[model samples]
Target chain A: MAGTWIFVEQRDGNIRKVTYEMLSEAKKFGDEVAAVVFGKGVEALAPEFAKYGADKVYVVEDDVFANYNTGAYVAQMVAMINEFKPNAVLFAHTFNGRDFGSRLAQKLQLGLATDAIAVELSAGKGLFTRAIYAGKALAKVEVAGEPVLGTIRPGVCEVGDVSGAGAVVKPAVAATAADVYQTVKSFVPTVSARPELTEADVVVSGGRGCKGPDGIKLVEQLADLLGAAVGGSRASIDSGWLGHELQVGQTGKVVNPNLYVAAGISGAIQHLAGMSSSKFIAAINTDTEAPIFNVSDFGVVADLFKVIPTLVSELKK
Target chain B: MKVLVCVKQTFDTEAKIELKDGKIADAGINLIINPYDEVAVEGAIQLKEKGVAKEIVVVAAGSDKAMDAIRTALAMGADRGVLVQQDTAADEFARAVALADAIKAENPDIVLAGHVAADDGSSQVPTRVAEILGFPHINVITSIEVAGGKATCSSEADGGTQVTEVSLPAVISSQVSWNEPRYPSMKGIMAAKKKPVATVAAAAADNKVKIVEFSMPPAKAAGIKIEDEPEVCATKLAEWMKNTVKVELK
Candidate 1:
């Protein structure tokens, strides 16, 4: 049955949690939620989608599908969309999803919206609420067209366990060189024991108050202690203490973690735009009048170097 | 090799966003070249400096003000520019179509733009242009090197960096850290005024989506602050994080 479709995101055959979250979200709309997963040897995870309320699982497997290639994934998705004619398609706003969604929308000339914090479906059309001007404001966009396409921001929607029809359908299609415009040579990952910043439930971030890498290391130690991700303001990033990927701001990644801990961050407007939507914000700063304190649910006027270590030591108790 | 750089003028990241009558009030707002697009312009200029590219053409498609974006690119060291005059507001698809229409005539070996615009933040026009032109597209790339009719690029991926080899005549979008943009020299500023910028009318397409409403995010709930010794504050903060925030600690 043609209905809402969720693009399953996976890395090395392990399905990302966002896919389940999207499926759970699609189920709430009272539509037939089918998950389309791509990659080689990912059939075993098909049933897992069912547990999260996927009515059908369309698996496209090929050696070339293991790593994400924009054109290849776009072509496969276009073929599937044409065949199934789903009214709506949802994807996680991860790197692959954002890249693939744009190209797919162009190839098909479909109305597509990206980075939606909230979404609703009416008469097969998608109404998406997305942050504009880098979270300074929110806009409600009416993506009204056939096969409405959109990408959901991470951590906004809750994961649900509603069961659905768990039929697996392997599409008899393969991606060749012509479908791929670029060849992936290698993937080098940053060495980090913490969670991915955007998808993390808890984020511990450093700012200018973080004097140097040593201070950031303390932040990282706390992140590791609590299984949270580490983030930094543009100041710390520009200071060369952290990578750009860890930056959270208007130019950087916007995070909506459940709990965001800021150490030495002054919470400038640009910086606040990124993490203001967080469920609960806490700040540790030497300045009691820091703007970060204004947005924080709890604040402490103390030096992070002393407070963070003490907090770590005490939490260990 | 020839490079074509696309740029757009948008509000600075710090500009206040004020919506009036279902639109953003443009009164006294400072618009500059999108920070990311400046990176793309810098990348193209670097390619030109290396003698690998003979010509760098900057292109922009928007209102007349978009010419400022092209002029800024020109002052930064591009050889020429193309301004596709699109006075009416359109979706990313239409803008891409117009841009691709302009790009097709140039047929450069490479096209570059920002990973995403600061205004709409759609991140579509360049990729869509690539699709329309039947070229490979890579976005938010940190570095690129060209040789033997191919581009080797390192792009930002979730949790990792993906290195890819794209064929020539590809589309590349730049991340902020790609390169530092240079200030236009006085000589460059005078030279940009003399730079040739061709103007063309935009192609038409139906608008795709309508913004129903714009609203500010809800205000943050009030919070508590504690000023005390590190030991006491740490104890209270940890307790607040675990009990009040209800997040896991250790």
Candidate 2:
């Protein structure tokens, strides 16, 4: 019987937190779960994956694997799947994962489900559930064949700790010419000190009601005080108050943080779809009738200009 | 220069979505163009203004009923529109494949789509189309530039933004923040009638995926307790985090 495989995505030399979450989620479905790590800093991540319930870790460490090249990564994934069959493959629902997961599924003639919110084993196979139509609808999908691939949304699966012994298995397949199809001369990452919006456990977002960019800066201050990432509605981004990087909407980023604090956002349906899955939501708006309050777990009926400073000061303490 | 942008129609976000008999109820909901495609259209139009692309063609694969969305794109400054008419119940992958075939036949210089349909948000359509067309593809592109037969796309990734350069005849899935799509002006709305929109039979697609059932998400628990004072509210929230959710903040 094939075991579950989790693709551990890393950048530079740090193991992303989502890898651990995927391992934690994988352990629930299969008796033996393994990890496939492609990049330079993977050796250090093996122990972390094991601490998160990985039975074995597949390490493909090479200079070529250091930077993300879609053609090469998808080729490597196909080769790995062909060699060591797995019942399912899980990936973080990131840009790289979204690029590779769908291509890998299409190449392998398999089904892929993206942004999975929940996963389980049913009737001797793996099953995944995800939201669709923005957050309007939920769909459950069952992957019937071997190597069922799924890319899970960040913050959806709880990161669990399973401190135990883990074995680091050297890459079973070596990188070949075909594995390095695309070449990258250099990579320049974004220069932002804030945590990524999708990965952040807490998010503070502003909307059209913020009045302008200065108000968004206030929202950013509150986010920083609370150790949260900054996010914005489509309107805020369109108004040039926030950079595109800070946008959270159906077509923007899907963030399911522990705490989602919305200020001056009326909670358009499109905006709510991206953040409704958050564990706890708090909306502060001057308009008591704003739609954001409908889905918010907690709401404050006061002008954000007044309430935000008080909240920020209190949280800073 | 020729550009192709894929568009889809989805329910407005605030529409009360209801599932009836294991399928999405077809309420008389107000339909708007998928927000992502609006970004794509905006990008295409911007390219036109830069003199890099002259003609923009918007295409969609759906039932005959989808002609309305095609008209909507025509109103948005597309030089022309094409509808790959198909029956209802078409899966996303199949629609993308068919649309890809149609686009390939047209041989546009750049093909762009909204990153994903808001209704489904599967985000697989463009990648599938790219694979089928054997062209370089990028997702979540916030910025773009075409020079010397190559396109440079800047996309938002998990921790940071990423940049990639691909040759022309590539596929790009646009994000909502890519550009502010222009609203139809009175002049453009009036000129929309002059644009030519063609309809053709959809190419055959082997759809392997199926939607068994769809349901609204589970309701959130009862109202959250908030203290009148901000300090008291924070304390209560902290208590709930520790006791109810078991998440202890440092």
Candidate 3:
């Protein structure tokens, strides 16, 4: 009687890409997958979840849930889990997920696994794999709780290939006013040309070798041509030449893209810990001695200025 | 106004870390205040210097050896330091619980901490601390302005920036943009010896998460040279993309 649950994260009543990825993976285990979404007028987004392989969509329309409230979201999730009695739950390893997951795990007295890159059905249950040590290693996490909870890194799992197969929208039986302790006054979205870092398939990151903020233009141009997300090393971010969201290092965003292009980055161990998991790495650096070259699938020792422009032009052709 | 900043001691990011029997090796590795936490400390001091806050308190969780780090912060202008002795690995949830308990005791107008520890790369602690305290929280915050029991913070999000206002007593994770943290002066280091530090034993942590074991990554094969000339390098890259890696060009 244990079913799989996916928290359908939404903003302005629209489904995010991560929601689809979670449901898509959940269906592989042949578990009865359900998505929990909270917001007024969000029932419209339920079918979208279905298209991505959810069995049922749990819609909780409440004004209090309009914006993200740290206290209320955690309380609602904790209560919903107790009511649903799920065997496993998957969440998008996002800011909100990071904020709420651990607390829910604690209240339920269940172990929480975070930022997992992949989850698979093993034996009768599921096993989650996550990148650890700043992306230097992979760790397979086994949860001790009867019901396992994991936050999946976005973009790691593919979108649903089987379309229009999921079930109809249903009201979440567990959502209650008692668990709502906080209210959201407003909700703001990040304004970027590309998708979320973890959700992006291709990431182009720059390092101190970019010279200054203006140097990001070259990286951005290439990313734009490839329709990829842009990232930076900790040094570039710390130097105020790039935004923190674009940093890919030990303390920065952990990304596992199909392709990662690092330009001008020397590839410090900390920096490598973030993007080393990337399936394909292409490094562009003037210094052939840069450590980043050691792990790169392809190394271009020439100036990124000369190499990137040429690559971009060739790709455009 | 009063602000509390949580500081931590971490191996310098530049240092090579070795795992010894599932734990970090205690080699001759030099320990420094986590750079992000140093930003938090600097932010707290800047607030105090601006006369926006009457006092700033710095808290840390570690062994007795961490007293030196606390003293370093005190010399940088933190009014007092609190040390929580715990043997637990500096994981996110555990540190959040301990920091939350300590912050509650102080009852500061705002609580500050780094978004993540550099070593673990788990950016869950600050937001977790915010949840445990039941406060509105913001991450990657660069600037903070307080007035009338409300603080407006500018957060660097996915693409652009977000300007948000939360009431006092909120939690914020400091970003590198907070300010250029000042270097500890010789005078400050000397004055730190006179500052007081209170160490308390933390309650037994209910460690829910467990690491099965730690292992290093497989050694990368030696990199192949992309030939000598620029055009040849480009050709070689193209050939590798088409033949070996089989990456299709758009």
Q: Write the per-residue lDDT of candidate 2 for residues B127-176, one digit (tens) a residue.
A: 87887787878788889989998888877666666777887788988977
Worst 10 residues of 2 chain A by lDDT: A177-186
Candidate 2 overall lDDT versus native: 0.78
For each candidate, report what fraction of the true interface contacts it reproduces. 0.80, 0.37, 0.30
The better-scoring model by TM-score among 1 and 2 is 1
Q: Determine which window of 10 residues in candidate 3 chain A has minimal summed lDDT.
A: A178-187
Model-by-model lDDT, in order? 0.88, 0.78, 0.75
lDDT of 3 by residue, A132-158 (tens): 656665666566565677888877787
TM-score order of candidates, top first: 1, 2, 3
* Chain A alone, TM-score per model: 0.96, 0.94, 0.90
Please rank every candidate by DockQ, starting with the best.
Answer: 1, 2, 3
Top-scoring candidate (DockQ): 1
lDDT (tens digit, per residue) of candidate 2 on A10-70:
7776777888888887777646888888887668877877889889888887776877777
- In model 2, what is the error at residue A265, expressed in angstroms? 2.8
The collision pairs in model 2 are: A133-B119
True contacts kept of 1: 0.80
Q: Show model 1 residue runs off by greater than 4 Å.
A: none
